[model samples]
Target: MSIFPVYQDVVSIANLSKEQLPFFMRHVTVYKRKRLHHHDFAELALIVEGNGTELINGKPHELRPGTITFLLPHHIHELHTTESGPPLQVYNCLFDISLAVGPQSDPELSNLFMNSVEEFPAYTDLSGEAFEKMKRIYLELFHEYSGSSPGRNALIRAKLTEAIVLYIRSRPSFPVPGEKSLQPHPKDHFWEMIQYVHNHYMDDLDSTLLSEQFGVSASWIHRSFKKYLGQGFLQYIHTLRLRRASGLLIATDMGIHDVAVEVGFESYRTFSRIFKEMTGITPSEYRASYAKTMK
Candidate 1:
């Protein structure tokens, strides 16, 4: 199923009730695609049919029927049809956290479903019978928001809260470490390798080099990295690069070209392409705007 009537840049403050939160529902019968540029909200997408790749931080993850992925604002991601057979159908919902609370709000709950940090996008999935329950609740909330029933707004808020809270409370495993390995084994060399990559990301990095350094096969590195981080190796490198780029843009007056090379990109063109693909903006534009905000 394709998510047609493509909704882009949908924004809402965090405190919105079911009635207040922006509601989007549609059917895409053809190959429909969208890139959410520099959004200030978190999003939840449910795929009802067909399949595609969810490109997050430069990695392509398979999106299948029954797949649900939540995107925090910091994540530079997009959805596209991988093939030309049929259009995929999807539902996208979004809301921003900044509007949810004042300075005195509970930091945890108030954060909504986004990660303030550039860590692997935080997410959870409901499987088996759990998805069915959430779907029913979502349908009910959607219907209410679509109707004019009395107290419908309150009812929608209650139900939406229930759906989100249930997922939050169930505590799906963090993507970076996978759901397993809550406790670190002394010999868990994978964590050591991950830490190594995190530390040296800005330096010349590659799968072959990582394999040689870590004494593992390159393919093993690829599999383990994705299993834990929800992305492939090169994608993770680009994520680190884009994250550092954001910091430089926000914190320094360096030229965009210099910043690109400093972050390990080879050329301005490649840098701009990657930056736009990841954050939905060119490096110079991001730096200029961020500079304005800082002043």
Candidate 2:
């Protein structure tokens, strides 16, 4: 267990619907700051007023009206308000990656999440017409998120996608020092590979198989998995499988071995061992525990 706080969507965001939309939006006023923390979901904050400094991944960036900060999963960050100024006000938005980008998303837009953190700055300062455009988008997002209008989900997703695309467009095209340029980059196909794994995690997938399918080397696959996802190839696959298995255990009447095989585990024994190792419970125990809760 890590000492620092790691917020998850299901727990941190209120009224987050797993079956509906994995999105949350709110107007936040920060009178004081909290301890440094990271989250499992993606976040975008548009500073509407006040003065502060945002510390992202140990780097400080000035915060004021028209400043936009986008944080990916596991990017440690903290916000601090200047004593002389009023509380920092911002439209804070939290969402899952699936809400903004998907398998069919434009590669350039998908790169916003897939590209390495070192390749681009997390915060961007906006001014003039560009800032106003983004401000309107965030305001519209807040309205749609809070309203009972029909087609609300679709509109919210569209606005969120627009905000992300605009943010990406606002970034400089040139690469940072010692980093490869954005165009003609090596990680262009990385997002595609990630989507492929999501769509086929239940199959026999590995770095070698993905490498062949994506025309990238096995070493590159391993490195990208570590760099972008913060986990190794097999660990990532097991994570997906275990997540699906956990859901099935609670949501269905499938047998333990059947659930394991359904999630791509070839051996029941291996699935049980890994499930216990990762979740600290056997498959049968997990399902029974859920049943007990229901009762």
**Of the candidates shown, which would achieve the greatest lDDT relative to the real structure?**
2
Candidate 2 stretches greater than 4 Å from native? 1-3, 6-12, 112-118, 175-295
Q: Write the per-residue lDDT of candidate 2 for residues 1-295, one digit (tens) a residue.
A: 2223333433224543224566778798888774566554578989999988887654567889989988865455678898877999989888765555677556766766556234677778889999999999998999999998999988998899899888877877755453222222355455446547765788988888888898888998877777766778888789878876865676556788999998899999999999999999999998788677655
172-275 per-residue lDDT for model 1 (tens digits): 44545533322243433665575466556768889999888977889988877677667778987897778667655654567888988888888889889989
Residue 93 in candidate 2, Cα distance off native in Å: 1.5
lDDT of 1 at 33: 68
| lDDT, residue 286, model 2 | 82
Model 1 ranges off by over 4 Å: 1-7, 11-32, 36-38, 98-108, 111-120, 169-171, 177-295
